[model samples]
Target: MAESEEELKNLLMKVKEESAKYGLKRNIKKTKIMATGPITSWQIEGDEMEAVRDFTFLGSMITADGDSSHEIKRRLLLGRRAMTCLDSILRSRDVTLPTKVCIVKAMAFPVVMYGSESWTIKKADRRRIYAFELWCWRRLLRIPWTARRSNASILKEISPECSLEGQIVKLRLQYFGHLMRREDSLEKTLMLGKMEGTRRRGRQRTRWLDSVFWVTSMSLTKLREVVEDRGAWRALVHGVTKSRTRLTTIFTIFKEDMSHILSIYLSANAFQHSVVPVQLVTHKQGFRVTLIEQEHEWGGTSACMEEHGLGIWDAHQNAYAVHRNTAWRDRSLTSWMCSCMPTPLVPPASAMCTEDWCGSP
Candidate 1:
């Protein structure tokens, strides 16, 4: 832990020096330490007395009710409200609500500057994963639409949909804020593009693109070809900026990536029900592939290969073991590297029966 802290301090110091060149200053106190696990809201029962007692206990623990009694009270109030808000959120069909909240909480450092806003975790020990997520959501709720999109990196890592949703929200905010000149509006309209794609096979993954071109060219087949072109990938992201339709189109690609990764389990005929965390790693030097096999009953093995073109059949067999390729394609047939061998390590115990149970991060 000491070595880790020292390493972090050195990394931060380096970042500070680098930022000085751009006249941008970073306050370490405002930075968030990355956390692992997911978040969920527990069902609160036992009526009003139980709620008040729960609130009082949490309030007393975080605050002494002295010189900063008001601050303490405020945190308690915020926690209560977050709990209530979480309850309302639970009523919805979305399971990612807690995770979205966690992202916002993780960004609390920036939101605090907005004033009068605060957050606190009650019964954090009960479920740190969901609690942290809720903390994020509360902070996000308080962020102005325009400013929210500024944290694109954080949004992509946390909730891509919310990040894209925020981009749309920002446009509406700017238009209403009187900051949208006619040219600015036109520019915004033209910028409506999706922010996701598939990695190129024998490359990383593949994503669908070209909705903007489709809209402009009025040709569906041409649009799909252009979007899937590996050479134009970076250019496409720069072109589209504000359209929800474009964003949805991109999200569809993102979902496609998830679907491809998850398909491994379905093909293997292993545990029919399982949630596997997928990671797509790209190296600057060149493409490398390594597969880790786990022994959990509920868990299953995964096979991934880089492919180009949106279609799975277009991928080259050289990218992955021929026996493993199910629905993926490869870009460079000669450059394919397969890491389909199972790891020697053993998997952890069986996962909890409930889908809400978050395994090791």
Candidate 2:
């Protein structure tokens, strides 16, 4: 840590001297030191630079802790502003909701997702992202906060539906995949570069590469493999961001394993008393459940029922469940719904789950 500080100080001092030689002046008052590690304040020349917890550089906000939550929050606020700026058109009956949503996405989504490709996202960050998304959608739909409708109800009217997180993931994965393809480039080396040091107190925050694993559902070894074929990767990303049903299904299966879906399918098949076998298949979009419509002993010609679309968000008693029953079932037949709700922000765990969980920096 001391060595790191000396190196930084030497570089800054050299910069100051170089500025003097060029007849340029250094403003110590405006300049602030934002250290990442244990070394706090340091002297540039004779003036002592005070360490700051947060600072902005080239429009990107950075915290001493190196987490993106603060930046994400700021981006969301900017997105809200963008949405508000177009309030007249979005709320205007002169335009259709589809056009309004397109305008919002084209105009405001970029603001919301600025620099998201580099974010080391945490669950708190996800909650904030979804919260802002919900706010934007609610404004677009003119749904009051006091209304008792759920996300499922609101999703029905959303034309060309998509998700905030899913898009961010797609963008990030695409960016990473691009970089990974250019193995001989300096950017690739710098991006994949690592520094050796024992971490400070608590668990380490998720790095860009670590977060990409969750986004792509690939291990470290396979990251390069997935990026080899740019067309395939692009199609994969498109499938994720282009369809809201696929996005929801991704989140659904991401939360639970395919075994859970298999169990449900098995239970359904057994309950129907059908001799026909049921098969569970996984795809990029989601699970494909295929089963005989009826047993030959109980029916004539062979028939089949398959459920391939996204599931439905159903509320029974007091809890909620996403249903994926076959198309033959009327209630949840191939339904696609968003179960987005405000997830309670919890203190980050010391150990991060290798799957989808992330830690605060």
Candidate 3:
């Protein structure tokens, strides 16, 4: 806690003197020193304390560099151990999926998220958190790695209301909000106060407050004002986390559907003599694009334009379209066909037609 080694020595001596008066002895063997810059050796009563890179304190890993990567890795390892302990319960066929999910939520998640409220999450940390969550789900479902099930598919099956990363987000925001509303204290001062020193050259590392700013998408001043109203702050946190979960689900489904569609179209034997039109269908869950083969009886000529990657011909317009660099936003059948079709293949203005293929134009 001291700014310099001399000050720290003085504070340690004062503590030792005060404790001796109370018939208490400091455990020199249990003491360790960590520094952000250079490591320094310290002696107390002719016993030198150990200097270490990182150590665990109160169930969380503390590193001199202030990076949470090691802490996150340790947490994941602990979570896996917890999962292993519950393997019999999770793998039991008699246990309902809901019951198993409840067990995991109650047991595994807490261990993984023990000290997440203080984590300065980075992109890599987020990925690790997500992977650990999926690992837990796979273990509960007894899904082997050889099954080739995607993370999205597993998440869809689980349909969790909140993801691990989302929970971390909620906790970080809640902690920040709590600190913002508190009176003067050591934690608050350390979080919000500035220290004297010139920062080292190069890019600055992500801080805990930076993670808060990212999750809330609000500047520090605005966050301070909003956090004053506890009700409003809670609502905001809930809404943000909920929206993130919803968007993640939607995007996962969309990506999986797109991949399926691409695989179907890209297969070498996808088309033979007939040209099949893929129909894009929307449902409550997500988009579904089905590629079914059908005979083209009124066709002038059938050409499987595999070079374009995606080929669609309008039966009514008598024109063929090649899908190259086309955006997915254009949903109308005719508009999509015409806009994507090359200049030479585009139908005449008189023959152009607007048709709804995906149920909406």
Candidate 4:
């Protein structure tokens, strides 16, 4: 801006004169002026524009100090509102945990972290973001505030790689990569260009890329060189985006609403469970039953056992029994065929005829 009153008047006149050629006029009432140094009085054709300490552009808060703290706070507020908008689904007994998580990731998270790629996050901003993310998880999971569940445990259920911070890192890195690939664009030039200006009286403000060292493990100079190799840059991002803090298991689903589930088993170690239709295979050694064991949650494989007589069962879905005294080797043919059927159909011992069961099947 022009420092002297005469220069300011001439500069403002020139601006007005240029606009007159296009028949355009500045909206002085709508225009606003902001300055970092001492406030000054200026006039444009007897109209004065209002000065403001801060203003909003797009969704971001533009502060005179160029701090992103206000933007982060606003993001949190908007993000929280987005979560609250889905409160019904989030807290619904009918919605599964996975679905709720998807809702948050697909909808709420993006809204909250919008424009995060340009953020120069401070320690306080990091803390606020993390706390808000944790709160979202706790709320979605319906975990009580009084609960002492370790963050590790909660993070085990839902990966930390999927958190807000992780998302920002990914988005920023991806943006960097996109900028790297572009040709002769203003965005690319600005990103690569060094600022040339009078220095402020204190330490230099943090550049958005300053935090990216953790992901790239390289300074801006090296980043420019390395990012040219798209494959390597992608690999770096994949490696960084992978959850380093995951718990031992990532379950697709847990013991959820077991009212509709019967005869289910889980192995914590295996991170899998038995599904429907346990197999019944007939072996020469009498018969062998194949089904997942209902023991350790970590039960790794299907269990095989000798043909056991039916014990107790319900009429629907399945019937189960075990031959307590009969060794699999000692079991008779009649027991093998009758294992799945009722005792009445199986009948007593040696009277039954063996009619080529394999031929029938």
Q: lDDT (CA) for every model shown?
A: 0.31, 0.58, 0.65, 0.59
Candidate 3: C-alpha lDDT? 0.65
Clashing pairs in 3: none
What ranking emerges by TM-score with the best candidate at the front?
3, 2, 4, 1
* Model 1: residues with Cα > 4 Å off, grouped in runs: 1-161, 164-169, 172-178, 182-361
* Residue 57 C-alpha lDDT in model 3: 93
**Predicted candidate 1 versus true structure: per-residue lDDT over 1-361, tens digit per residue:** 1135457556766887899999998753344342122212211121111111112332332222212234434443455455555454444456465564553343332222122112221223213322333345434454434564433233333442323222322333333223222345643343344447765558522211132232123354544455455445333332222122111100111222344331121111111111233323222233322222222221123322111111111122211122123321233323332222122111123322122222222
Better of 2 and 3 by lDDT: 3
Candidate 2, 1-361: lDDT as tens digits = 2347778777777788899998998888887777777656767658977788898887889897777888998999899999999888987999987888888889989998888888888868876876677688888998999998766456456733457777787788788888888749876886788878877899877887877765455786777776788887886676545432311211222222446532121111011122333222233234332322222122211222122111222221111121222222334323322233222112124312343322111
Residue 93 lDDT (model 1): 55
TM-score of 4: 0.59
TM-score of each: 0.18, 0.65, 0.68, 0.59
TM-score of 3: 0.68
Per-model RMSD to reference = 22.9, 13.7, 13.2, 20.1
The residue ranges of model 2 lying beyond 4 angstroms of the native Cα positions read 1-3, 184-204, 242-361
lDDT tens readout by residue for model 4, 1-361: 5656578668777887899999998677777656675555446677876667678889787877778898999999998898888888987899888878888888888987788888888768877887787788888887888999865567557654345776787888999888887888887887778877888998877777677874455887788887899898887776555422222321121123433323332112111222233323333333332333222122212222122112212122112323223322343424443224333222223312243121111
